[model samples]
Target: MSILLKASDLKTPMSASDLFSRTGPLVFEVGFGDGRYLEHLASANPEWNLVGAEVSLGSVWRAYRRMNRSGIREVRLFKGNARFLVRDVFEEGSLDRVFVNFPDPWPRKKHLKNRLLQVPFFQILSSRLKPGGSLFLTTDHPEYFEFSVQQGQESLCFDVIQGPPPPATLETKYARKWRDQQKPIFHAEFRCHTVIPSAPRPISSIEMQHATLKGSLENVGPFTKQVRRFEGGHAFVMEAYRELDSQGLLFKVISEEQDFRQELLIQAWPKKDGVYVSLQPFGDPMTTKGVREAVLAVTDWLVSQGLELDQTWV
Candidate 1:
């Protein structure tokens, strides 16, 4: 099984043409809520690349599993906001088709800024879309649909139209609701006419880490035993595993490098007692020395805290 690394980890990327090497043209859908429409499209168009962006963890997990089981090899799914992937991972003119379907309306006057059809969003679409690439947008809310159209025209990258696109996409949950209520599912197809604009460059490392960590913390949980990737991978998860008791406050570290092998490295770091430190080396034996050095560097910087550190325990 492929390891689902933290959001901060590396991802496999390819050139715009190579992105759809195994598949066909890369068709991307952002804010793919309840994903029934994505299912219909990917299943129907097996030759095309199907990329989905979903903010909900359960939604992403479900959609990925469903598409994989459907034998849709061209699909790639991300469990994060659309902005992070578009502004960071994708290059200019990388996508063939972009979809924004029934995003959060943010109806309150104070909350309207949170809607997905803001000015910067149109700019991003302009950068990602190919020279004749089409962006398909749909919303049940008339106000948001008009707002999106206004923003697109103001950006001067898209000429908006109301109705079906060249090749119509499928229907989702919100669209079904609109149909039942006799409410029109407002639609538009925007064609990129000229050179795409460049985004404000990628953020700095500090800003980048802050962005990725926000997504990673969504799946954090309590664990004592090591959580390996697919029961055979190197990545280990240690969560809430270092609580110190007043009595026997020994820290145990466990690692799994490969299948059928588990190594346990126990480091007994006790304050007001050098016996435990003498029994075992002060270093965190489970990790490499380089990681050990990093731990020491961080711990050594905390000397000013009210909590005192022993001469040798980390």
Candidate 2:
């Protein structure tokens, strides 16, 4: 199995057997910055499956190289919001331990909403953790640590306990930076006391579909930026480009559903009978309702421009 995993590599309800060569326990690290702590976990527990999520592409590549150099095999890494894995992928009671090492505090009052470890997330995390499983958090920011504990308490699923920082956590890049300045690091463990029911999944897997519009580009009117809102999300058609060679049109679209956001392109090209409107697979986006609605919105715009809506599968 490859060390790097994409969003599509994950199943709706992920299984441990499919992820690791040998699974003694499943450990997940959120925003595994430079991956030093993740490497530590994998090296110390070769029998365990160490899964990590990182949003930065540079960090993902750096971590991938570090793991390769160490010849680590019982690990898998994902480059996206870790919440998606916890909320939509992992099966209930699948996680043994979770780690959050020096996560961004989002200290400003206005940006507090951007902070992770909120009450809803704590509840979701509680559902995924096995009985007695705990989420270990180590950070230099005292306020964030206290906020997380209070949020976990509000969830009513965990017993927050002050604890010593893990050895691996102290050696991370951020940890070393803080240590050089003699800043105090706080550690806590939120042990699961009661496993709540899994929260409803806001995003789901769907097959991307195309629409067959019975019209010609010559008959279509000028394109304009459009926005469409659906049940759980919204999409924006940001720009349109006309292909000079084939007279095709491509639209750049952005969609947001919950915490997940996707930017993709939809192409409208002439066919034998009509114009074929479909999503271009340039970004490897997970086909979700928002993305499907993006295509629908584009097709609807063409219809408003006088194109005949022959059929649509979105």
Q: Please report, as a residue range, the 10-residue window in candidate 2 with the lowest summed lDDT.
A: 199-208
Which regions in candidate 2 have their CA more than 4 angstroms from the true location?
Answer: 199-204, 218-224
lDDT of 1 at 305: 21
Instruction: Kindly report the root-mean-square deviation of model 1 from the true structure over all alpha carbons.
Output: 11.6
lDDT for model 2 comes to 0.87
lDDT of each: 0.54, 0.87
TM-score of each prediction: 0.63, 0.92
Candidate with maximal lDDT? 2
Error of 1 at 218 (Å): 29
List, residue by residue over 103-181, the lDDT tens digit for candidate 1. Answer: 7888889998777666677777777777788788877788888888898788777878788532333357767677788
Per-residue lDDT of 69 in model 2: 93
Error of 2 at 81 (Å): 1.2
The TM-score between candidate 2 and the true structure equals: 0.92
lDDT (C-alpha) at residue 266 in model 2: 92
